[model samples]
Target chain A: MKKLWWKDKFNIFMAAIAYLTLLFIIAAIGTVIMKGFPHIGKSLATPEIQFAVKLSLYTSLISTVLCIVIAIPVAFVLARVDIPFKSLFNTLLDLPLALPPVVSGVCLLLFFGTTAFGAWLEEIGLPFVFTIKGIIIAQIFVNLPFMIRVMKSTILSVSPRLEFIARTLGCTPTQAFWKITLPLSRNGIIAGTVITWARALGEFGAALMLAGATRFRTETLPISLFLNMSTGDLEEAMAAANLLIIISIISLYIFNKLGGDFIGGTRGV
Target chain B: MIKLADVSITLGDFSLKNVHLEIRKGEFFTILGPTGTGKTVILELIAGLYRPDAGKVLINGADSENIPPEKREIGFVYQDYALFPHLNVYKNIAFGPRLRKMPPSAIKENVQGLADMLEITHLLARFPGTLSGGEQQRVSLARALIMKPKILLMDEPLSALDPNTKRMLCGELKRVHEKYRCTVVHVTHDFNEAAMLADRIGVILKGKVKQVGVPREVFERPRDQEVKNFLGVEPLKAVYAR
Candidate 1:
């Protein structure tokens, strides 16, 4: 069999890189699976673990919803409107993504802990420190950039002509957005939501700093794992870590599938 | 009943400087130009998509600068047929009326009427993505026409179709224009299309209306070198050799 000279070295190198990447990913996944699954069933069934799981799910869902509601308008403005200092707004939106989660937690704590703004918030019965609400705020702050980026691209991908057509068809600007822009961008919206929800679900450092690791109160899964590790209970810590790993895997799988659907559907359009 | 008075626009590098033109009610007017001549900008200006940097756009004798595109009561068909890909043909056609909050029965009747007129009744259940290029164009035209807009603006609507489909749709468009009796501003780079479809042709070169006249007048009698070349006026072989 004759082989082309160009294919000989380059092909083998590319194949080796691909195989190594695949092997690394498989190894990471296998380790998580091996350590996490056995503890998941019992922990998930226990009342304390169940409450933490339930709270995590509930808060993340709410935070995801809130992020979407806030992000869509901001994304639209960023994508379509000629706002002042657009680059600044874009940079600010992406800042959280670049910042370490622990730093973000600290920043949130300073902004909302006993400061003038925090005092005002407290007076209004809306304090955001060491509360369940603080967890949601942290998740929202971290997840907002992901949603905004997704929505901005989605909105950008759609031709402005379609909206113009809608308006010419007698839809008010709001109506055009609701009927045309929203429906056309449904896939991107869902994909963004899933990814944002997953990010919120796995949120650890910010939740730890802002909400604190109070058992059965503000203790999310990551906090539970941290508390277990600090207490020198390796089995419980490993169990909690394993449970989180399982959830992350399941959520990631769904996100990948849905994200593909969103991207593929829009491309065909 | 659409008039533009000294409309000037600067869209990045291409600029329309002091452009003036008018389309009377029930007339099929075409803007014939080369690519990047800002012909579509004229239609968009009239449709209120872009506010002119200078001058006025009048719809039915009213200054329409403040009017939104949706409120302009004009229907536009883009070059790519910009149909809502998520919507089926029936819904796409019904969009305008539904936005207007016309009764469901009226919307259905109007959609069916336009669908029947365009011979796209069978494809009404299919999404725009599933439709052929010709089918998508027809559906786009139907969607625009069903609104019964005061003026219909089409920007190279048939450019995406096959030549045969283009020819066929041209006839259909003429018939539709006749039935509706609406003023039309059609932008196309194809001289043949302009000649076939225009009641009056406005020749735009580099964003300015170089000349405006009937098809025969613009084509047969070349006023300038640019207009002559645009009309494909090849000098006789002997004259060229000379």
Candidate 2:
């Protein structure tokens, strides 16, 4: 072989940089598993830890379902209809994705904890402050924008020409959407659902602020980890971190099984 | 019968300015034009897909402005056929009838009868993505015709096919029209296709109809230089005798 030139050496350096990041991630995850995997059995048997796991699953599942039900119509409107101030509305919708989770939680608190609307909601016996309902609301708030982003791209991939043709076939606008647009968006919807569920499961700062760190009451996985770390309980903290990592891996595996367009709903008809 | 009187629409950079036409009942009227001249917009206007900015569209002595496309009862055949990819050919043809809540037995009868007539009975089980261009067009026809639309609008329906398929489908189109006996408003750029199929032809240039009459009259007696340029005809002479 000829002598390696500077360009070839630089390319090798780039590959090494990629491998370095990959290695860093693997080592970090390895540390977590090595420290926590053995204690997982005992930690999970704790009543508070069991409640945290149940609450995380329960809230994320409900939020994922609500996100999908709301995202379909919202994405269709953004993709197809020409609403005035659409760009402004879109920016507002995407605000949750850009802002810190704590700031969003603060905003939610100001609206639902102290304002007239909060008073009205409390009067109706439907409160969302320092309760399990507050945790579900926080999860939905954090993940709905992402679900809509994925779903909107998927809807955009479907041709408006198909809907135009359906109109001439004696179907109303709503009927056309039901028959044509929704079916073509099946892959995108599945992808959005998976990603939303994963993100909701890992929700932290908003839940911590809004739902409070009450044990056996509103503790989700991330909140459980935070509360356990605060009290210097290494075993419980490690257990929480390991469980989250395993869940993230499972979510990624399901995405791999689904093949392409798992994140953006970009499949076309 | 259908008519567009002083119809105008401004969409972004292109505009149809004061266009007019009168398509009689059961007549095959073809609007011939060059590309990018808004030929498709006229067909869409009549189909109620696009509303005119400042004119009246009368359908059989009724003002059709307030009617939406679903209520217009006009069938549109896109250039690319616009078949639903998820549904197989059988369900695609049965879609309109299903929307009407027709019984399964009647839907099967109509779908199978139309499929046999279109020579696509064997392809019913296949999805649209697997079929060739000609087959997709034929299925599109069966789908639209099953609704029994009284006014059919076609926008370059044969433009996407190969030359041989185009010629064959042109014949099939005429046969379908005769069997249906509906008013047809076909927009195309091919002079041969218009001459072969149209009872009367309209020449559109720069968003206006320059001439509308019999094909022989419009061809032999050119309206102006623009119309002649659009025709782009040349005489063939035999130089060598065999």
Candidate 3:
């Protein structure tokens, strides 16, 4: 069969776009490896690097758990409840995503520094400036919007009638949430947690500014990489970058595989 | 008897104004109306899913306004079946009794008994997503009936079924009503279904009860032209003059 001329042009245009996209992605990966891989083995195994990695993983995990525990309920209220000023609540939750990471860090610092509330916290024996706690607080602030947005969409996709049916069947509101709503939205929660954890893990500007990047103390992996690069320790910086890349890729892959089910379940109407 | 005395509610895009209804115990009452006529809203109001803006709902001469849905002693089945996709048929049927803190043995017996009644015993272990439309409908019915509520409100329960399944389920529903002697207020837009199952038929239009009587009375002796047209029994020739 003879092909139409426009069809050939359309195919060529589509091929060009796909090719460029793949090329861009490959270029990014090549650049990271070329600049970072040579020092991976020894630097990754070093005690300081190991400590930073462990601390970073643990803190990000904690921050992610805290963010999800708080954000899921907030997202549900935003999506499902008839709270007053609902638009305002949604805008405030999304503000962090729009702000730069350093701006977020500054805002956290001002709120949690030796200001009045921070002083009150200090008096209560809960200081959160230039400490590991500050790092977690910063991560939570930066990653919260992603978790909330994911969870809000997920909860919105569920028909409210299902919960109503459960309620009529004698389940309390809380029981219905746990037994019906939560299980139905499991894929969204999982995808959101993965994305939030990845975001928390790679947090740099906020963690450095708020946590002070002190070696063997408040230094998370991203902060360590920044500190190392600034001090001309190229090998250590490259190793940390490589490790971050590896972790991010694996997390994103799993997120894509599982997140597909969530999006697929809600595709047309 | 469940009675709605001068009930009024203004939901978005729909309103029920001075809507009055009395569903007698052990009677199969069908609320027949076109889409957006507030048939489902009436069921929701009775089930305590929505509070009326005005008037009172009395169940056996007691006000039901303060009672939450779980305590309202009413069972509701939605048009979409609303089966818990996460739960298998058995768990879905067992949910109400479990929530009531019934003993495990009793819960099992009630669920199995209802499943057997609906001929859904083979599908108990399967999740709702795995069941056919007819199977899901039966499972939903079983779940609602296992609660043994004071009354049952079904919102267009057979609207989603294929014609053959709908016919079969209509017969099965009649049998179920006879066996349990449970009062049923079934909502449907189909005139044939109303004629087949309802002891009394109420035609709702624009949120008002235009007519309520036995099915033959509403069909053969409609009080208004709207009810006659709605029942699809009007002559094909035009009756209006400009």
Top candidate when judged by DockQ against the true structure:
1
Listed models, DockQ each: 0.83, 0.81, 0.79
How does residue B108 of candidate 2 score in lDDT?
99
| lDDT string, candidate 1, A68-103, tens digits | 999999989998999899999899889998899989
Tell me candidate 1's interface RMSD.
0.9
Chain B TM-score (model 3 vs. true structure)? 0.94
RMSD of each: 4.0, 3.6, 4.2
Give the DockQ-based CAPRI class for model 1.
high
lDDT of 3 by residue, A6-36 (tens): 5687888988899999999989887878988
- Each model's C-alpha lDDT? 0.85, 0.88, 0.87
Residues B1-242 of candidate 1: C-alpha lDDT, one tens digit per residue: 88899989998888999999988888999999999899999999998889999999988899998998877878899888899988888999988888778999999998888888889999989988898889998998989988888889999988988999988999898898888989999999987788788899899998889898977778777789988887786433321221
Q: Lowest-scoring 10 consecutive residues by lDDT in candidate 1 chain B?
A: B233-242
- In model 2, where do residues sit more than 4 Å from their true spots? A1-7, A253-269, B235-242
Model 1 residue A11 CA deviation in Å? 3.7
Q: On residues A20-100, what C-alpha lDDT tens digit does candidate 2 reach at each position?
A: 999999999999899999999999999878998999999999999999999988998899999999999899999999989
Ranking by DockQ: 1, 2, 3
